[model samples]
Target: MQEKALSPTVSTEIITLTINGTSKQLEVEVWTSLLDLLREPLDLTGTKKGCDHGQCGACTILLDGKRINSCLTLAVMHDGSELTTIEGLAQDGELHPVQQAFIDHDAFQCGYCTPGQICSTIGLINEGKAKTLDDIRDLMSGNICRCGAYTNIVKVVQEALERNHKA
Candidate 1:
């Protein structure tokens, strides 16, 4: 006689996050990536999942006012965190300054990486380390634009930085 085998159970936990200014309490599997958590259950698709290995920077998002590659992190690791995707950057029907600057400067092509670029740029400016054009370049190197829009992207960052300094 043969015995029946038991199936493995999936681990799940409840987490609370303030996403795009809205508080969300979600139950997710423990092994789910932050990128999947945003794109799947939450339906916030603006944060793209490119490469899914943290190399392409397409899954970048602001976590606690700092930018991080969402694909590199697990959702369970960030409970009670404030998170922002591209969807969170606008307010009262007005685009964020960085979003407007990107439009004014024509900083994107194909736009797959635009969300991450914008989020990362905002994070860079907040850090206050980009004093020169070269510094912006170095600081933003993590974001890769396959369409080769670096020149205009840098222009947008420079202008946004200038505006931030003036404000």
Candidate 2:
């Protein structure tokens, strides 16, 4: 009996992105989500994987300085866009203000959602969306912390914003 040849599977498509400060090109599957492509292909694991669905903000990343749920977006859709992850927020081994605020305020419990929280906060600050406590709450509603440290998270974000404003 002769074995039949199996059809080849295309696992990647050409993708180009400006991540952090550098440009990157990689062959990724058309259906691959930005989260997977970022974590697996690019080795930028700072973006955590929670509920692959958009319900959770665990896979949040900055697209052109705006926070977006990476799991809900396709890698190819952002071909020429600028991308920023938790990894990009730090510079010269220094944590971004938001990241430092989270640490200072003990904003996270399990630390599983820290990256998303930080990313979302970055967006909220950059967009000037986190003005009042209610505004912060509304803006961060999408990112859920399983440990329920929301109060501290809010404080951290607000504090970070204040510090950023002062700087």
Who wins the lDDT comparison? 1
For model 2, how does the per-residue alpha-carbon lDDT over 1-167 read when each residue is reduced to its tens digit?
Answer: 76556956666678789999899887878899999988997899989999999888999999998889999988988888999999888899998878888988889999999999999998888897577899989999989999999999999888878977898
Runs of candidate 1 exceeding 4 Å displacement: 1-6
Alpha-carbon TM-score of each model against the true structure: 0.96, 0.91
RMSD of each: 2.4, 2.5
Candidate 1 accuracy as TM-score: 0.96
**lDDT string, candidate 1, 29-140, tens digits:** 9999999999998899999999999898889899999999999999999999999999999999999999999899899989999999999999999899999999999999
lDDT of each: 0.94, 0.89
Instruction: Check candidate 2 and list the clashing pairs.
Output: 12-28, 12-29, 13-28
Q: What is the alpha-carbon lDDT for the whole of candidate 2?
A: 0.89
Q: Which ten residues in a row have the lowest lDDT in candidate 1?
A: 1-10
Give Cα distance to truth, residue 4, candidate 2, Å.
Answer: 6.8
